[model samples]
Target: MKVKPWLSHLKPYPPGKTLEEILKESGSLTTIYKLNSNENPLGPSPKVIEALRKSLSEIHLYPEASYLTLRKALSEKWEVFPEEVILGNGSNEVIEFLFKAYLFEGDEIIVSEPSFLMYTKFAEIYGVNIKRVSLTGELCHDLEGILKALSPKTKMIFLDHPHNPTGQCLKRKDWEAFFQRLPKEVLVVMDEAYGEFIEDEEVPLGIEFIKKGYPVMVVRTFSKFYGLAGLRLGYGLGRKEIIQELEKVRQPFNVNLLAVKAGLSVLSDLEYQKKTRELVLTGRKFLTKALSELGFKVYPSEANFIMGDFGKRVDQIYEALLSAGIFVRPLKAYGFPTSLRITIGIEEANAKLIEVIKRTISG
Candidate 1:
């Protein structure tokens, strides 16, 4: 059997190591801190758990094909109409919908060089040309560079705001300038996987642009701030017409029953949401200051993780942390070989990580 010509060249996405994988590798280390995947260290909301428990009985049935209840909830939250909302198994599937509905083979999409790997991966899978613009010196997306790279064939641009790996975000002015210069025909897919973690008031949410009537789709997920990674729930907000086209390509019953229940429950859990935000903001500051004090160059992050350049000691430090039952993501694939992307863990886990790093460096 013959595979597509590009199939042989495609590389699999390198996900963060699992706790099970780490424990197996570091036998006898019972206490494992998984600070790699940028998960909510505080865990899911109690309300979400209760909702899931109540939903267990419905596992045998298919979820509502339209997911209207969840969509209505999201529409209200984002101040968009239900018709403008599209849910995915994860926001990733929403991305695939764009390819299925709009992109054709040989068309082009622009992405930052070190942005989410899925954008390029999907491009490769669909045989679409990808134009990768490198990030600026400050590790933020070069909006100017992206604009310069656009061509007539460019159909879409995928930007992971509060950018993945680095967690750097653009200011409202930067976003405004980019949008002003962007072609009206091209769609902008704002992947806000980490949007809920952004504490800075200056940082603009993608939904703000959608309200202004830009051809933008803001993709968000429950996996981050809601602590529902296991549920794999995410949604996209855009103009109703754009969403309608994408909706045509979405799979029926794509989001499961429990995830829907959990999403609805969590949406109303104001207290849980507030606590999650406070934890991430405080932890982000603590880790940034702690890492910098140890002579590491920590990038300012709006997301739940920080990317610290540990100089040449990164490898040794990474290994030592692993042996000590700590797991943080190494960013070699994201092009920063000497840096580690550490998720802001709980207070105890953060302290342990700081102490472990200090000891590793001193010894």
Candidate 2:
């Protein structure tokens, strides 16, 4: 049997190890602190749990193919027409929708060197050409370099705001400058997976650009801030025509029944949202300060995770933490071998991580 020749070169995504995997590997540690995936430390909202319980009886029925209820809720929340919204199993599926709708073999797309692995992964799967621009001196996307890399065949640009791993974000003015210079033919896919964690007022949300009628698609997910990673729900907002085209590529009922219920329930849970935000903000500050004081270079982050450079001790520090039943992300794949991306866990988890790091480094 023959497969697409590209499959020979494709590499699978390297995900963080699960607690069960860690336990099996170590065999001695019974407790685990997983600070790797940048997940919400507060877990799911109680309202979401209640909604899921009620929804269990509906498992026998298929979810509505259009997912109108959840779409309308998101539309009202974001003040967009329901027709402009596109739901996905995860925002990643929405991304695949873009590729399915627009990209063809030999077409080009631009992305930052270390932005999101999925962008490159998808490009490889689709046989689309990828132009990877290196980040700027400050570890932010190099907009000028990206613009220079664009060609007539370039169809899209995938940029992750509050960029993954490092959590650096571009300012409104910086985005404005890039948009002004961007060719109208090229579409910009703003991956705002961490949008809810952004604390800086100067950082512009992608919806602001969509409102101004920019050829932009803002892909977001419930996985991060909404604590719905297990549910696999996300959506995209764009022009009605673009969304309609993308929707045509979507499979019927891609989102599951319980995920739809959980998404709707969380949308109305204001108290849960507030608590999650506060916890992330407080934890981010504490981790940043604590890590910096330990003689490490802590990058400024507006997202729920902080990336710190431990210099020569990165491998030793990571191994020590794992042995102590703590797991943080090592950034070698993102080109930062000496850095680690630590999710802002709850107060206790953050403190425990700090204590372990202090001991590991001192010894």
Candidate 3:
């Protein structure tokens, strides 16, 4: 059997190495620290853990196909109707659904170059042409460039808010301007995976645009601040019609029962969410300050991670950190060879990282 032509040239997506794999690869488990993936250093919430334990015995059963309970809980939290919500194995699935439901062969999707790799990956997988617009000098979405690139064949515009690796955002006014010039049939997806960490009021939430009758979807994940990446639960909010369209592509029982129950528990755990937010904010400040003082170009961030350009010494620093069992992400895959994206860890992990970098640079 012959595979699709598009599948031949496409490279597989790279996942961050797991702790176990890191230990095996490095030959040492003792001193290892993982800041590579932007996962919560604090781990999952206690309430979620309790909920998961309660759900353990029910693993034999398939989850409710509609995931109604989780949707209802999210609806109450976001003040939207349950019909407007769609659950996914992760927000990534929701993204895939958009393409599956709306895109025909030869259709195009516009996305910021080096924003989220998955948009490009998904486009490639689904045999859609991707019109890549470069990020502005500030590393945020170039709304004007994207708007200019839109065509009748464009099905969607994928934007990652508080954008990945760069930690920059598109302001509300910029979006308003872009939307005014956008084609009415084109869908805009705001991937707000990092929304909980945003400190800027000027950046528009995707939900706000959707409520105002814009053809948009706000894709959110419990992975970041809710600390549930392992459970792989995420969702989208949009017009009820848009959600219904996605539902047609969704697999029955896509979201497992444990994740649904855990998500429900964590959605109401405001105190836990607050703690995770505050921790990331504080750690971001400390690390940004330290890195800037050391003369690295630390970009202004409103997320749980910081991106810094270390000039040509980035490779040396990265290797040194690896030797010391500290794993942070290098942005070579994102076409940023001299830059690093580091997840904000606990206070001790943050301090240890600073110490390691200091020694690496000085030595």
Candidate 4:
């Protein structure tokens, strides 16, 4: 009876089901392939595992309150000052920090319709009105539409580069044009959660805009390419003043000790980083080509996942694949009823998934 009016209608974000849940659902423990979430199929780097093992004994002590060491490591990696970086439990937390620091009820934010669902999720939580523009014909961010949606109430614009669900990125020139039209009052949050896997030369990385003095913040995650999803460590880069403000809203010891240690060890592991990028690129192309050859329309992707429209057989195919212990993300929630977003997994998983799809389609 005491719940706020806003609380009455809220629904939680639907995270993908756990591997254990899928195993239980299918009644099979072996031969399961998980490509539903865009996770690194190669698993965490050996260095991270060793680092986490070393930190286990010191679990009694709390993590460094300021997280300075992790910040310094990120600074060295991104060529930015430590003061310009703010760490998060995950990049998702950084997004939350932005809302806490800047949002008030009745304020508005702009977002692409099919980008990261978290943008709208958080907006609704904060009672911020969201103006969502649909993607253009090529499935890229419609910069013109975004510009048209802007207004005085617009407090921020959240963009997921190499957008989630679609995996298409806006190029530098397109971004520049959009920036030129945007008013200086609108702060931009560029979520580059999967930036490292991008192989496109024309796509502009978020850090470049931050360097240009735009009121923009670039968020990066160790989750995808670093294979540290379970560790929950990510960071944001912005103008020193903006980062300092975000830092003030951050809780002390937000990042756990083991994740901090793992972040430091893996951030500089050049060999593992190289192998991760290579695996995703090679695996993405292989899966895309294979899926296309199987008579599906595979959208071009620059990230670690590809989106394919499976036509009328989507729901049937999804259930059949689930029974076969292969899990891929269905996009019905993102408003694409006939599409599934498949992560670029290991070579064997990719090959086996294709085989399963062929068998399912044939039946």
Candidate 5:
């Protein structure tokens, strides 16, 4: 049997430890405060839960292939036309759609080094030539470095604003500058998975750039702020022409019935949206201050997670916390040997995490 040469060296995305798996490993703890995956600490929204229950009866029916209702809800919410929307199983699928529609083998794409592994993973799967530019010293996307690295063959740029792992955000002026110099043919893919949690007023959202007529595609998910990670509902917003091309490559019925219903319902649940946002924003501040007070270097974050450099004690503290039923993301895989990415939890959970770190470090 012949295998694609590009796939031979590829590794599957490493799975995060599930509660069951973690319990088995610990052999003791019953409660797990899961913060490793950046999921909403609140779990599914109450409105979403009710919507899903109502949607259960429709599971036997196939979802609408175009997902027009949800698309319209998103378009109204974002102020874009319905034709500018394309739904995906997850935001990750939208990334794949971009590859399927535009990128071909040997075409070039630029990504910040260690931004999101999935970008490079998809590049490798499709045999595209990936150019990874180094992030700035402040751990933000190096817009300058990216511009210098561009070539005629470049097709897209994938940047996770409120960058993953580090949780740093670049200013609005910087983004505006990038678009001014970027080539018209190259589309900028803003993977704003955590966009809802941004607290900084100076940072710009991808949607704003779209209104300004810049070449950009914004990928968003229900997973992060909406407490809908399990639903796998995500969408991309772009110009109608770009959306049409992406639609051509998208799988039929890519989003499920329940996700569509919940998505539509959640959009109308303005109170629930407000509650979730407040929870993330407040928790983000408390965690950052507490982590910093503990003598760790906490990076400024517009996202819900806090990235802290625990110095040489990182590995030791990570294992200790895991044993104590507290799970946080170790960043060694992302090349931060002395840091961890911690999702902001509810008040008690956040307090517990900080307390554990304080105790582990002091003794």
Candidate 6:
């Protein structure tokens, strides 16, 4: 009886500190900003609340095996055929579906260094090879480098647009250039978890590539904009053939009942979607300006969070923010020890974070 020999030293995914854990260390702060995880500061849409309540009676029954309704809803939203959509428990499950559907024991996947931890984590889990390329000095994906890194054994590449930790997105020209050189044999999976928050018109969505007949899969979630992170609702869009292959390995009822209800309800709640976009955009502008004025090098972000570089004072500033009932994400685990990832929280949270940072540095 033995585990895979490769798994002996594989590290487990590190989740952020929980509220209870934060409170214990901070000695009972009365109000916590809790911006670490990039969750929508707005709670679930009102429509989702009602739908979840209505779905309570169905808890005893199994969810629809094929989850056709939710799948159909997503397909219509993206203008893809029903068979081209795959409903996943979260976008993570769909990502794993790619691994399950395609890769062999020694196959490889190319990833940006420190982009998304799960990409490398899954590759390790399946004993797939990982080829990591560092992001450009400007902190955006090095698309050219990735094309050069591919091999006959390369099965996929994962790109997280409005990329993690730093929140830098590639321009349209760069994306097109990359795709032009990419070989059709390797699939490119765009992890657009933060896609909704994009404000720049020049930043293109992965669906644009899919429509052009590229071997691309676009993974998205209802978590951020719709405030359904707790529900674990997500989906993937690709050509029907790829979607069909992935579906074969996807477990029936993978998406829970309430999540389906919440997803459909949220998609219809245009007012809620409007409010969230305004909140993120307005807060993003406010934080970027404020953080920059305070001498932090705030990068351009199309996501709901911005990355700020604090130089040698990172730990001092992080602990100070924690004491003041604010919790921003530290990027040491993402390999940027001197930077912090601050979510574009509600107006009050955004303002309070600024006030605390000002006080911390001035003192």
Summarize candidate 5's per-residue lDDT along 48-90 as a digit string, tens digits: 8898888898899999887888999899999899999999988
Q: Candidate 4: deviation at residue 39, Å?
A: 0.8
Instruction: Give TM-scores for every candidate, taking all chains together and pairing residue i with residue i.
Output: 0.98, 0.98, 0.97, 0.97, 0.98, 0.98
lDDT of 6 at 223: 78
Instruction: List RMSD in Å for every model shown.
Output: 1.0, 1.0, 1.2, 1.2, 1.1, 1.0
lDDT of 5: 0.89
Query: How many collisions per candidate?
Result: 0, 0, 0, 0, 0, 0
Better of 5 and 6 by lDDT: 6
For candidate 1, give the lDDT.
0.92
Kindly list the per-residue Cα lDDT of model 1 for residues 124-235, writing each as its tens digit. 9999999999999898999999999999999999999989999999999999998999989999999999999888899999999999988788989989998888889999
Candidate 4 wrong stretches, greater than 4 Å: none
By TM-score, how accurate is candidate 2?
0.98
* 196: Cα error in model 4, Å: 0.6
The TM-score obtained by model 5 is 0.98
Candidate 2 segments whose C-alpha is farther than 4 A from its true place: none
**lDDT tens per residue, model 3, 1-363:** 999988898888888889888999788447777898889888888998988898899999998887888899889888999999999998999998988898888999999998889998888998899999998887878998998898889989999998998887778888998888888899999999999999889977888899888888999998888888988999999999989999999999899898898899988888898899889999999999999999999988888899999998999899988888889999999999999999999998889889989998999
Candidate 5 regions with alpha-carbon error over 4 angstroms: none
lDDT of 6: 0.90
lDDT of each: 0.92, 0.92, 0.90, 0.89, 0.89, 0.90
Q: Give the per-residue lDDT digits (tens) of candidate 2, residues 153-191.
A: 999999999899889999999999999999998999999
